[model samples]
Target chain A: MARLTLDALRTILVACAGEDDGVDLSGDILDTTFEDLGYDSLALMESAARIEREFGIALDDDDVNEALTPRLLLDLVNGSEVRAA
Target chain B: MSTQSSTAAGASGRRVVVTGLGVTAPGGIGTEHYWKALLTGENGISELSRFDASRYPSRLAGQIDDFEASDHLPGRLLPQTDVSTRYALVAADWALADAGVGPDAGFEDYDLGVVTSTAQGGFDFTHREFHKLWSQGPEYVSVYESFAWFYAVNTGQISIRNTMRGPSAALVGEQAGGLDAIGHACRTVRRGTRLVLTGGVDSALDPWGYASQLAGGLVSTVADPERAYLPFDAEASGHVPGEGGAVLIVEDADSARERGVERIYGEIAGYAATFDPAPGSGRPPALGRAAELALAQAGLTPADVSVVFADGAGAPDLDRAEAEAIGRLFGPHGVPVTAPKALTGRLCAGGGPTDLVAALLALRDQVIPATGRTARVPDAYRLDLVTGQPREAALSTALVLARGRHGFNSAIVLTTHRP
Candidate 1:
């Protein structure tokens, strides 16, 4: 599997929010909390699950709780994939 | 009729009254919408749109084409539950609002409880998981699948979400469990619980749900919409499948009075349950005995019952059996009978609670709703089956009868709240 890209993670978060189909989120989505984007726990969970499935990585319970924003989640996903490789 | 046997249990126990009603039925969304649709005698059954049933024997169902779960539920709840659970949650929202309560209505400190019944829970969710297991692998399956299909999920979720800490349970009597749930609620209230939420919700519209139902061979295979599910009619072949639920706020009458609840629908004056004869036992079904016991517990005679909500099982023998049961209790053609289920097909366990909601509405409005789409009653039934339009009457008392597909029989007696 290819490494997780910032653009790809942005697309997943935007889709999980149901804000738009393919809006460009290459800016500061990494710093914005899910609640700041009007995304609920359900949306965040969906994003986490999709990230795991798409990147072929497992997120532990603590990692999921710690990854409250896009940047944190991307780091976790990258770390898991590195460990797997 | 022995008065002692009839009034003994009722006189000693705390009286239970229906304070609020909520529904997500095929015909409409809320209680008012449902009642109006029933009054117009409209048929809600249509060709199944959930999937292609063209090759299946039963092609029609009481499908809710316009249910948008997001409209009634929060996003957090959507990921963990199925459509049936969504229906129960939505219905609970309506029932609580109708009863003038809120999520934080101060009942958290009181002994409020919830009791729900369903033969099968969330088959639609289960079907999706099975497809995943077969196509992708078990590893791709979801953990939510465990509680979503469990029959008790409704009660568990309702109690948890609403902060109800009293006695809560789920009953599994298939069709009859809907009415039985209310009976159980009443018993819970009589045992000192202040209030209880009771009802049932089920949907067999998907492949797994429909396949299990098809195996029973009891669904209507009629191609024409009008001819399908003609309960109590000579041409009655079988029932059409349906998906929906109803929830009622069953409360101690005194507690409701103290809470200033002005709109009491009716009191659960009596209820009874009985088993059908073992196959080939040469004895008639025990539905009539159940009816007799319910009426007796209500301290009422057949003459006191203003209307009879027929089960309308939609098979010839089953219809005749229910008719005979009514006949034995009320004498031949003794009471005005109607089966509003012809309007929305059989909702499995949901049907009985839906019928109870209709009966309560009838008592409140003083009009007996018609049995939609059923034109003629077979002579063998000897019932004054209401049809065509809503019948205006003094519907002060009603008996709702239900028999599970699995042979559980139950009857509940409701009377206008006198005190």
Candidate 2:
């Protein structure tokens, strides 16, 4: 399976929770914390549920919470996919 | 309860008045538009468009067609709230703005509160979550469902948005609960709260909600919008369920005057609620008692009330009971009675507050909007039903009545503010 990319994650974030005005998601944002990127815990939880359903991956609540940045979340999701395979 | 104790508790001599109104009804979105629609007798009931209701027994509804939530609410709130909450938040925004309570208005957070009513919670949000539970397992459900499906979510969200940390509650007595919530808010204001955002807004038109409404056996199954849901007409069958309602900024008269509030809609003179005796017990229904108690609390008589906003249940037995109550209280065809909800079907928890708004508007304009599309009132009912056109009258006081499904009756008396 292909790794989860920042672009795919951005799409999921926008779909699960709406983007804040003036917050550019297309920039170099992988390392930016979700709080700085204007996404809250509820938004992240919604994104995680959507990702789990779409990518056939299981994500623990702790892992989702600990993945503060898009890079960390993508790594956690891809790691879960590899382990499931 | 003794009359003295009840009077002391219910009417503390502290005046509470409605300063601003925000409405999102079937025919219109704002108070002005809704009032215009009501005066012109526009029918908002139509074929249900929220979903395909072809399979349901009742296929028509009073649905708000052009409400785009994204235009009124912020982006982040779009995911966490349901349509009903969206309506309420927007209405609260309009009401607060109308009341001149901007961020710079300098009201203490604890001085403002919110009280609302809802018969069903966010049924659409719950239905979506339940579908995911049945299809993809419970893990797929969104976390937002925790608060979004609650009946009190409207009050919670409004309180958080506006930082109204004072006394807050959510009532649920079906249609009558709307009036009960405002009645409680009146008590809150009398108890020293400066202002309370009180009213009701409801939307349960989803397939699951529709099924439950139909199960009640009171919805009009008529297909045509013109002929369906005729309240008080001789051929009245049943009411069409509707979405949306109204919210008002109820404030202490002294506080409003101190704040330099320019317009006071009317005073919340009196309010009362009663439960009917058990069906077939041979005791009379208690709707008239509720009205009498409200008037007595206001220190007024039945003859002083200029207009009566009837419940207009649309079903034969319920309409007959309401008509007989009105006839007995005000004498046969003695007082002008109207049901502007004939335009927007029964709104459950939303109906009573919306009717209250209509009554206040009538008091403001000094004219009674006609009962929409109900012309052939039975002679036996003996209701001086206002029809055909808005009637010109010297309106001073209005009584709004509402009844929930299982005999919950409530009445509110509004008198023009004196001094």
Candidate 1 per-residue lDDT over residues B117-227, each given as its tens digit: 988788998999899889987655665676888999999888877888899889989899999998899989988899999999888788888889888888888977778
- For model 1 the local lDDT of residue B359 reads 97
Structure candidate 2, residue pairs in collision: none
lDDT of 1 at B291: 89
TM-score of each: 0.89, 0.94
DockQ of each: 0.15, 0.66
lDDT of 2 at B295: 86
The Cα RMSD across the true interface for model 2 is 1.3
Query: Which CAPRI quality tier does the interface of model 2 achieve?
Result: medium
Task: List the lowest-lDDT window of 10 residues for candidate 1 chain A.
Answer: A16-25
